[model samples]
Target: MKLNIKPFFIAAVLFFGAFTSGFAQDNLVNSLKLNASEKSKDSFTFTEVINIENTPVKNQGSSGTCWSYSANSFLESEMMRNGKKPVELSQIFSARNAYLEKARMYVRMHGAVALGEGGQFHDVINMYRKYGAVPQSVYTGLNYGTDKNKFAEMSAVLDGMLETIVKNPNGKLTPNWDKAYAAVLDTYLGAYPANFTWNGKNYTPETFAKEVVGVNPDDYVELSSFKEYPYYSKFVLLVPDNWAFDQVYNVKINELTETIDNALKNGYTVAWAGDVSEKYFSWKNGVAFVPNKDFDEMTVQEKAELFNGPKEEAVVTEDMRQIAFDNYSTQDDHGMHIVGLAKDQNGKEYYIIKNSWGTTNDYKGYMYMTKEYVKYKTTAIMVNKKAVPAGLAKKLKF
Candidate 1:
């Protein structure tokens, strides 16, 4: 999909920074030479809906399980939106379930699939269908005796076991392999609850899903953009974390942003999977923006200042998006909820992202990102079908 990015450029910075000698004069004449200290803001506005409420600030804690943390949070909001009180569902339960499923797939495919501490949004749905879910209060996965979800020891053991099993040193594999896998899960997360009570009612996991949380697993859709596929067509998003390879429709960048905003305006929240490694991504300070100047142009002293202060320039472009992806610079590092939009002290607009990293940061687990930052960084987003704009929805046939 062709992403419209000129609207995001604060000025006519040298396109791609690749001016030929013949065009050098023209390039220098028109090249945006604004100082790194100068500032500008986009002229658009947005408001929040799907009001964030009672979101339990759970920590993933040294695990690459952003997928688990994020989707469980998504379902929590789903419960709240449906008039049930909000609940902090156990992300570790979902994570354990997904790990077992992934191990099965890995062995079945002879280890072709990448297996690690990563997964996609669909993993949560699969967990809901396969093993169901429980509130964090029920099974916190703290059996390892840690206060937070730490998977280093557990994941290493699981991966080693799967690798050994996949090799199948014997000519045949054991039929009880699945049982063995479940045994490992039981050890880590404790046994799944066969029947439990909530709000003075008896319920199993499946019953809780059907009667209480009431989230339709099929109601959500994933969307992404890349040139390899036809725009607005469904394709398996080719990311390692997307182990399910669920087909997500490709749309232009503007449409993606539009869908997110429309969803927020209409009282819906979005599950955002994106890259958070850029220097401008100040999760520590709870802000993200594109500085207008290049880092190479700054002196040693000024470059140090760039780290200490807000960058006014950082020559962002469509190609930088491509380069980052191609060079492995942009990656599916984290998942968060885009809960609202806001303008910074400089009047620059930023998408208000609610993160699961706890309320330790200056903004208490929230980050503000500009349009450029979102475009360059987002890997994919899942939102309610109703969140899609009318035009974009019709294009994708909703």
Candidate 2:
């Protein structure tokens, strides 16, 4: 089923940065706190229509590593769905491994690649397939005299080192530069363990990943919807954080939404990447929606109603979504897990999203995102290939 939406003139909303690091969370929380009075006026209520069992919310404190946290959480849910014991996998292990690889690429490209705390869902899967994973208890990535993940000082030092290397001061690059870089990572994020014991058994990262985690990296597929790309074909998502340049299968907007609905109905969760900078995205109230009226045109009551409950949403069209992408309004900003479905007081549907910002929001680290918001702001989603409908899977070549 295709949506025949048409574009119309609407007041523009300001664009914000895409990456959700530890600093960004602090700012978001502060902003929400300041708007407490406005949010308190709302009267929104949600009834859960579907809920998937998953692990507790985690805090990626002082780190820009939501990509790893959300992907690992999704894998934990997959394990539960598969009848395996749910384990809190180490997010930093993957982050550390990916960081090293990314640093290598940055230097190889003469510092042209983006280097920081942003990544795609595919990064976690690729890291698992290559370096394997460890339980969070096994590796917390807190080696720098702190109990939480913090990378500010470490990031500056690494960036400086890379910049110096890119300059080629000696006219001939040193073969041990990679070793030097690895040393810095090891000093901060801790060295990768060659082997470790868990549950009274000894295993290497590879064996543990295969025998215990038991997730097939290939079993998952990343999908997106954009009018510029041919339907049923793959294209590289042009996001800066996608340093690895992963390809996503492009489908019509309706097919993308239908796939998400089908996945949740079948007890599967999704890893979502999208923009969260809209005027109606109220993290404090635990609601995100695309209101029908423009921000400037809305009356005080209408603005309050937006957060209090579901309301009529703007008609999001292919051109509108594409324009947002083209003009840098819809950014690849944050990564989250969509675990369930909910309906507002008026029976409008919303995806129950699990965030990695700890339990601070009205829903305790979870938010209800309206279908219109998802349709308009989404960058992409990663889902278990089996969860996709047979028809859509065929189109995706899965």
Candidate 3:
């Protein structure tokens, strides 16, 4: 007999601009460049170690759709790397299509599936393989008349409608429910085009994706590292945003870093997903690190040194990573593109992250994440399967 699963509300995983008081101060300090002098004891001196080519930064703007933006950015970079002319694929094209499909899954599961603006990196691949893609000019998803996305009312109305349908007051679902759902999406996000002209040629979304995007969705893989799962094997990433239940290859923490490094070294950029709620993750300073001391416990000098100088970092272990995951300290909160690497004055290495929250940070929508912070806080990452070393790729059976 089939078992019934009940749906319950969890806190939504949307990224907003609400930052803590400490984070606010960090932002102010970063804005003032209070420690920017080369010789200042309170300044961080960084040199670019490795920088990869990528598309320009774009803002997500009042929307919880960084996954779409970052994944699309990754695809755009992939197209450029493949010798194709760069074109900005619409993030909302993927997001809009994914939403409709997710609604169907939620309804099919009798509302047991999680539904929100949050999604995993694989959601883009899945959407691309199914509905195909369009350029940003073709499907802007801004039918509601705002230049940027604001989905509070839309999310509420959609959730309420799905919940009502799941209740099944009439004991049978109507045939038009899907149409009704589509109508709501079309009203807010604009109707997806059946065919459009691009670059003086008439093309459908699939044709545009094939001839223009020029990247194989199947060539990418999502990977993660945790002690709970066997190394070099696949496991479902346990996160609320992973409502699709996508499986990622699990590797040792060191191997995970090696894979990332190898990928970047081999001219590939990574789609990075991790927790950004830690105090050490400074959006304003455009830097993230694993501090030896907690923010509250640090002296004023130590706090200044956080931005201007380097300190000893805790050695992150697989067990430490697993405990954070099991205890909810590590969460899949945001997604960004890992496009390059940098070194601080003390020669500590950091990964260059391209964020989608607009060009507000010190680096103008980019941040430098410490290697320690990445090892400690990352939930999962996506890279081109070819970027993986041949031996590891063979083991993963990619």
Q: Number of clashing pairs, model 3?
A: 1
Measured by TM-score, how close is model 3 to the native structure? 0.90
Looking at model 1, residue 62 earns an lDDT score of: 51
Clashing pairs counted in every model: 7, 3, 1
Superposition TM-score, candidate 1 onto the true structure? 0.83
lDDT, candidate 3, 1-398, per-residue tens: 00011111022224411111122212223333432323332367779988889999987765667889999999999998898888999999898888888888889999887767777889999999988899999899898888877776787788789999999888999988888998999898998788999889999999988888978989999989988888888999877667778899998888778888999999999999987766576676787878777767988867665665566788889888899878867777778999998898888898999988778666788888888888888888999999998889988987
* Candidate 1 C-alpha lDDT tens digits along 1-398: 10111222222211111111122112211221222222122222333323455375565665666677887887888787778888788888888888778888888899887666677787888789777877787778887777876555666667778888988988799988878877877886687677887778888888877877788887888887665678889998666666666788888766777888788777677888876544455555565666676556667766444424334645455567667777766666567777777654456556777776666555566656776778777778888787788888898997
TM-scores of all candidate predictions against the true structure: 0.83, 0.92, 0.90
The deviation in Å at residue 232 for candidate 2 is 0.8
The residue pairs that clash in candidate 2, if any, are 18-333, 43-308, 44-308
Tens-digit lDDT track of model 2 for 137-229: 888899989977777788778878988999999998999998999899889888877788989999888888999999999999899999998
Winning model by lDDT: 2
Poorest lDDT segment (10 consecutive residues) of candidate 2: 1-10
RMSD of 1: 10.5
